[model samples]
Target chain A: MGGDNAPSVVLEGVAAALEADPALKIVLCGPDEVVTPFAANHERCEAHVTTQVIDMGEHPARAVRQKKDSSIVVGCRLVKEGQAAGFFSAGSTGACLAAATLVVGRVKGVQRPALAMPLPAPSHPLLLCDVGANADCKPAYLVQFARMAGIYAERILGIPNPRIGLLNIGEEEEKGNDLAIKTHALMAKQVPGFAGNAEGRDILTGDFDVVVCDGFTGNVTLKTIEGTSKVLFKMVKEAMMSSAKAKIGALALKSELYELKDRMSADTYGGAPLLGCKGAVVVGHGSSNAKAVKNGILVTARAARENVSEIIAQTLAGSDASNSEQVE
Target chain B: MGGDNAPSVVLEGVAAALEADPALKIVLCGPDEVVTPFAANHERCEAHVTTQVIDMGEHPARAVRQKKDSSIVVGCRLVKEGQAAGFFSAGSTGACLAAATLVVGRVKGVQRPALAMPLPAPSHPLLLCDVGANADCKPAYLVQFARMAGIYAERILGIPNPRIGLLNIGEEEEKGNDLAIKTHALMAKQVPGFAGNAEGRDILTGDFDVVVCDGFTGNVTLKTIEGTSKVLFKMVKEAMMSSAKAKIGALALKSELYELKDRMSADTYGGAPLLGCKGAVVVGHGSSNAKAVKNGILVTARAARENVSEIIAQTLAGSDASNSEQVE
Candidate 1:
C-alpha cells in the first residue's frame, strides 16, 4: 500500500504470486473500496484470501489503533493470534516498524531488530545490517546485529558459520573511531562465529558473510554503494554510446550486457528484509511496480518457510556454547 | 621511491617529468648511486637534481629518521629550504605523511593536514577529504578539513566559494551521528559559506563543490565507488568481447568505448594532494607507472605556479572574508 502504484501494484503482485505458487495465500490489507475490484477478478480470491481494508491517507500507526479493521493492524493481530504464519507489509516502513514492535515484539534479548539490506554480488548477495531500523547504535547492539545477520545468511543464503565482519576503515584492528574500535573487539571476543576486522573494500570481495556497522554508517555506506553503482552504470553507458564506434560495440555486446545487468542490478534482488522483527517483512523499493512487488512477496514467503527466526535463535546459542566451554 | 615498483617507477617518473617541462626541475631522493645513471642521460637531470635517497627496505618512520639522505626525507628537505616547491611520492603513505609533517611542517594554525583525493566526475573531479589522514576525527577537525579542502578547490581547482557538504546518511541537517550532527550545526552556523548537508548519493552528483567527512566514512565511501567503477568496467569489457554477432556491433562502437574509458579513468587527474601542509606534496597510487609519476610532477608544479600555499593562507585568514564572517 506504500508503493509507487500502491494498491494496484500490490494487487497485481498478489495475483502473480497465487498464479505462480498455486498454494499461496495472502491477507490483502488496504481500503475495501480500493481492493475489492482487483480481488473480485481472481477466482479463488475470496476463498484463500482475507481482506481487512485500511484507509489510504490514514497515518499507519494511529489508524492501526482506531480502525480495528485496518489492514496493517489486522495483519499484526493475525500473527499475534497465530492466524497468519508471518506478516508481510508493503506499507509505510515507519508504520510497519512501529506496528511490528508494538504488536509482534522483538526476539528474546534482541536489543532491536535491524534492517538487513542485501547487496547483490555476481553470485550471492552481501548483507548489510541496521540499514534503516536503528539509527544510533552502541557496540553491544552492533554485536547482536552481527549474530542476527550471520544466522540470516546461514538459513536464507545457505552459508554455514557465516563470517561476520565489522565494517571498519583500515585493515588494522586498531583503526576507526571508538565505536568501530570497541565493536571490533566485541565481535572478535563475544560473537563466537565472527571473522576478524574487514576493510570497506572487503565487502565486494565477499570475504565476510555479514558486514555490521551502526545504522548511521551502514545507511550511508549502503546508499553510497547504491548511488555509486547507478552513477557508474550511467557513466559506462554514456561511454559506450559516446561515439559511432562505441555504439556498434555496444550493440554487439547487448546480449552479454543484459545478463550482467540482470546479475548486478539491485532490482533483481527482490527486497531487503527488516531482519530482527518477529515476522518476515521484506521492504521492496516503495517505487516498485508489478514485477518488483511480486518478487518481494515471494522473498518473504520463502523466508517464512526457512524459519529464519529460529535459526537466529540457534546461532545465539552457539555463543552461549563457547562461553560455557571457556567457563569449564 | 616508496611505491610497489620502488626506485624503478619513481626514477621513470622523474625522467618523464624532465622530458616534458624544461621548467620542471627534480631532486631525486633515494640511493644516489641508483639514480646516477638516469641523471647522466636525462637532459633535466643535473647537479641541481640533488639525490638524498633513503633505504627502501627500512620501516617507514624509522627509515625517515636513520637516513636523513633518504629520498622521502631529502625530497621533503628541498621543500623545507624552499629549494623546491612541493614533493611527490608513490611510496609509503605513512612515510610521506611523516616526512611532510616533521620536515615540511604544516600551514600556520593547521592541526592535521588531510589528503584530498580527486575522483572522476562527469563535469569536474570531486575532492573527498581525510581519505587516509585522520581516521578517528573530531567535529573541530572536520570543520578544519572543510576549510582546507575549500582552499584546494578555490586555488587549484579554480572553484570559487567552493560549496561544502558534510557527508551523512541523509540530507537532513540533523541526520548524522554525534560528530555529524554537531558538525552540521557548526557548518550551517559557523561555516555559512557551505552548501549545507549532502547524502552519500550526492557525492558524485557534481552538485556541490566540496564534500567532507571523517576519515572512516570518507575512506570507505571512496573505496566503494572505486570498486564499483572497476567491476562495471570489467563487466562491460567482457560483454563487448563475448560473441561474434556482438563483436560486429563492438567493432562499430570502438571509438565511443575509448572515449568512455578516458572519461572514467582516474590517472588523468594524476595524484591526490595532502592538503594543509606548509609545502606541496602529492601522493599517487602505490602501483603508479611512469606516466602517472610524470602527471604527479606536473600537478605539484601547477600548485607551485598557482601559489597554492599563499592562496590557502589567504583562505584561512580570519581577517579575510570567510573566517571574518565565521567570527561574526
Candidate 2:
C-alpha cells in the first residue's frame, strides 16, 4: 500500500523478522486484499484492514487528518490505543513523521521529534539527529535533540556518558549563524554531555557520539554522503574497466572492495528511528530491500522492548525538576 | 605570510606557476626578509613588502580593518588599485573572503559574493557556490548566487545553457523550509536557467551544472564530502590489510586504486574562485601543498585573463534592466 514495492516487500520483511525472533509478532495494516493473503501465509500475524491509501505526494499533516482509515494513520492509532508497542513503515517519510507526532503523540515537554541515524565512522558510529524531521528549528529544539539523542546513544548504543556535539560550520563558539551561536550557549549551560561544536568533517571522524543539527542541514549532509559514495564507487569501477591490465587487477581485489562497500552501506544500519514519539517508530527507506526491511522491524522491536520512550520521558522530567529546584 | 605552510610553500608555488607559464608575472607581497631572497632569485618576480600579518584565528573583518598592511589586505589592495589582475591566497578563508568583498569590493548591484568550486563528477564537473562566504542569507541572495554561478559555469566551465538547481531538502516547489520554498518560487519565475530543485544527493551526480545554497549548507555539504572520501579510503585500506590474502589482492590493485583516488582529489581543479567581487580571487586550502598553491595561482590567472568579473557585472545589469522593464 506504501513504498516502492508495498505489500510484497512488507510481507517478506515481516516474515523475516518473525522468523528471526520467535518473540516478535506483526500487525499488518493495509487494504484487505493486500494484507489478507500475507497474514494467511504466516502464524502470529494479524491483518488490520484499511480502505484508504495516502499517496507519497500528498501533504503529510493534511492527509493524516483527512484519511483516518489509511494504513499509516490506523497503524499509529494501534500504538496510541495500547494495542501495539511500535509502528514501522516504508511509506512516505513526511506522512510517517506526521502520524507518529500527531497520532502516537509527542512526549510531554518535547518541543520537536527527530529522526536519528548512525553514520559509519572511522573510529566508531556517530549518531546524527533530525535527518529530515523538523527542517526549520529554534535554538531550544536543538537542545532537546541533544538531550534525546544523548539518552538514545547511552541506552541503545551502549555508550556511557556519550559526548554530544552541536553541528555547525565551524568548531568555534562564536562562529555560525544566530541559531548555532544561541544553541551552543544553551547546550553548554544545560547539557552535561555537551562536548562543544562538531564541524561537518568531525561527523565522520567519530569525534562525538552524537551530532545535533537543524533537519535541513542534516538531511543535506546525509544525502551528500550517500550521493558521493555512490558516484565514487561508480568512478572506481569505470576507471578499472578502462584498461585491460586494470581490469585484471580489479578482478583480484573485487571481494575486498565489495566488503569495504558493504561496510559503508547505509543498509548495514537498517533504518532511522523517528524519536520523541510516544511509541517506537522506525522508518525504512522507500526503496528498502528485503534485508533492510527486516532490519528496520528488528530495530523497532528493540526500541519498544528496551522502553526507550519511557527512559527519555524520565530523563526530561528529571532535568526539569532539577532546574526548578535550582530556581527555588 | 598566510596559510599553514606559508612563505616557503608560497615561494615554491610562485616558482612553479612562473615556470609553467612564461608569460605570467608575480608580485610577491610579504615581510621584507621572506620576500627579498625569493624576489632576488626569480627573474620576473617583484616584492611588495608588508610588515603586518593576520593570524588565522583572528576575526576576518576586524583583521582587514585593523591590519591594513597585512599580506591579505595588501594583496587585495593591489587588486583594488589595478596593480594585479587577480588575487590568490591559501590563507584563512574568512579573511580572504572578507578582504575580497570589503577591499576589492563586490560587483555593482551584487547582494553577496560567493566562493564557487567545481566538484569532480562522474560525467562532468558540478559547480557549488557559497561554500563559506555568507552563513545566514535571504532568499534573494541565493537567487543572486544561482545567477552568478550559472554565468560562471557557462563562461568558465564551457557549459552552454548550464542548468541551475536550488539546493534544498527536497525537489518539490512546496518542499523545504520557508527560505527554500520562497527561493524555489523566485528561481522558477526569475531565473532563466533554473532547473527546479536539487537535493543534497544530486550535487555529485553531475545532474546540474550549478547548485546554489546558503553558505552554511554549502560549507557543511562540501566538508561532509571531503570527510567521507577521506574516511572511506582509510576504511578501504584498513579492510585490505586485515588479512594476508586481502593484502595481496590490494597490492595487485594498488595502481588502479591510486588512480581512482587521484581522480576524486580536489587538487585537480586548483582552488575555488571567490566570485562576485570586482577582482578575481582564488582561495585554496589552508593546508595546501606547493602543487595546490601553484594550481591556485594558475586558476586565478585564468579567471583574470577571461575578465570573469566584468562579464558578471554586465549580465547582472542586463537582468536588472529586463526585470524593471517587465515590472513597468
Candidate 3:
C-alpha cells in the first residue's frame, strides 16, 4: 500500500525478515485486503488496517494532515502511541518525511530533522546529512546536522569518534558561498571531530566518515553520482558486447562484475534514516525490491534496539550544556 | 608560464595549432626565456614578453591587479587593446576569470560573466553555465546565465534554438530552494526555448541542450560526476584483476574501454568559455596536456571567428527591448 510494489513485495520482504529474525515481530498497516491474509498466515504478525493511501505526487504536508487513516500517517501514529518501536516506508518520500515530523515529532532541542543517507564509498559507507531536508538552511542548522550525523556514524555504523567534513566546492576554508563560509566558521568551534572541508571528489574517497551540507547541494551531488554510475555502466556493457573476444572476457568477469555492482547499489544500504526524530524512522526508495525492503526493516530494527534516538538526544543535550558554559 | 608543464607543452601545442591552421597566428605572453625561443622558431608566432607570473593559489583579484606583467593579465590586455581577438589560458581559474572580466570587460547590460562548459552526454554535449564563476547568485542572474548559455550552445556548439533547463533537485517548477523557485518563475517568462526544470539525472541524459545553475551547485555536480566515474573505474579494474578469467576479459575490452574513456574525458572539450565578456576567452584545465591546450586554442579561435561576443551582446539588447515592450 505504501510503495510501488506495495502489498506483494512488502509482504514478501516482511516474511523474509520474520524468517531471518526469530525474535522479530511486525504489525502490518494497509487496507484489510492487503494486510489480513498476510497477517493470518504469519506468526507474530498483526494487522492494523488503514483506510487510505497517499499518492506519490500528493503534497506532503497537506496529505499527512488530511488523510488521517492513510498508511504513512497511521504508521507514524503507531510509533507515536508506543505500539511500534520503529517504522519503515517505501512510499512517497515527502509524505513519509512529513508524517514522521508531524506525528512522531522531533526530539527536544532539535530545530529541524535531517534526512541522512549512507553513501557507498571505497573503504566504507560515508553518511551525508540533510540529503533532501531543509534545503534553505541556516549555518546553525548545518552545525546541528553535523553533530547528529557524527553520532549516527558512531553508534549505528560503529565508527568511534567519526570524522565530519563540510561538503564544499573547494577544500580551502574561504572558497565557498556565504552559507558554507559561515558554517565552516561555526563548525570549527562547535562540532567535535570536525575535519576540514571536503571537495566533491572526497565524497566517495572514504576520507571522512560523515559529511554535511545544505540539502540542495547534497541532493544534487547524490543524484549526479547515481546518474553517472548508471550511464557509465551501460556504456561498459555496450563496450563488452562490441566483439567476440570482449564477449568471452565479459563472461569470465561476470561474477566479479556482479559483485562490484552489488557493492555500489543502493539496495545494499536499504534506506535513509530520518535523523532528529523521537522514533526510529527509515525511508526506503520507492523502487525498492523485496531484498531492499527486508534490509530496510533490519536497519530500522537495529536502530530501535540500539536506542539511537535516545543516544542522539543525550549527545545534543550535553553539547547544549557545554555551549551555555562557553557563552557564560 | 600559465600551466603545470608550461613552457615546453605550451610551445608544442602552439606549434601543432600553427601547423594545423595555416592562417592562424599566436601572440605568446610569458617571460622572455619561455616565449622568445618558441616565437623565433615558429613562422606565425610572435613574442610579447611579460615579467611576472601568477601562482595558482594566489588571491585572484589581488594577483590580477598586482601582476600586470603576468601572462594572464597581459593576454587579457592584448584582447582589450584589439591586438588579439581572443585569449586562452590554462593557468589559475580565478585569476583568468578576474582578468577577463576586469580587462576584456563585459557585454553591455550583462550583470556578471559566466563560465560555460560542454559536458559529454550520451547523444551530444550539453552546455552547463556558471560552472565556477558566480557562487552566490540572484534569480535574475540565473536567468541571464540561461540566456548567455543558450547563445553559446547555438553559436558555438551548433545547437539551433537550444532548449534551456533550470537545474534543480526536482522537475516540478514549485520544487527547490528560494533561488531555484524564483529563477524557475522568471525563466519560464524570460528565457527562450525554456524546456522546463531538469533534475540531476537529466544533466547526463541529454534531455536539454543547456542547463543553468548557481556556480556552487554546478561545481559540486561537475566534480561529483568526475569523482564517481574515477572511483567506479578503479573498482572495475580491480574486479577485472581478481582472477585469470577477468584478466583475459580486460584485455579483450581494452580498446573499446579506452574509446569510451576518451569520450568522457575533459580533454575532449579542451576548455570552458567565459561568456558575456567583450572578447572570446577560454579557460583550459590546470592539468591540461599539449593536446588539450591545442583544442582550447581551436575553441577560442572559432569563437573569435564567429564574433560570439558581438552576437551575445546583440541578443541581450533584443531581449531587453522585448521585455520593456511587454512592461509597457
Expressed as tens digits, the lDDT of each residue in B146-254 for candidate 3 is 9989988998899999999998988888899889998898889999999998878788888899999999988888888888999999999999899987898888888
Candidate 2 reaches a DockQ of 0.66
Rate residue A72 of model 3 by lDDT: 94
Per-model DockQ: 0.53, 0.66, 0.80
Instruction: State the C-alpha lDDT per candidate.
Output: 0.74, 0.86, 0.89
Candidate 3 segments exceeding 4 Å error: A321-328, B321-328
Residue A203 accuracy (lDDT) in model 2: 86
Cα-lDDT of candidate 1: 0.74
- Which has the greatest TM-score? 3
Q: Which residue pairs clash within candidate 3?
A: A249-B249
Q: Distance (Å) between predicted and true CA of A293, model 1?
A: 1.7
Q: Clashing pairs in model 2?
A: none
Q: Kindly report which residue stretches of model 2 are placed more than 4 angstroms away from their true locations once superposed.
A: A321-328, B321-328
TM-score of each: 0.88, 0.95, 0.97
| Candidates ranked, most accurate by lDDT first | 3, 2, 1
lDDT winner among the candidates?
3
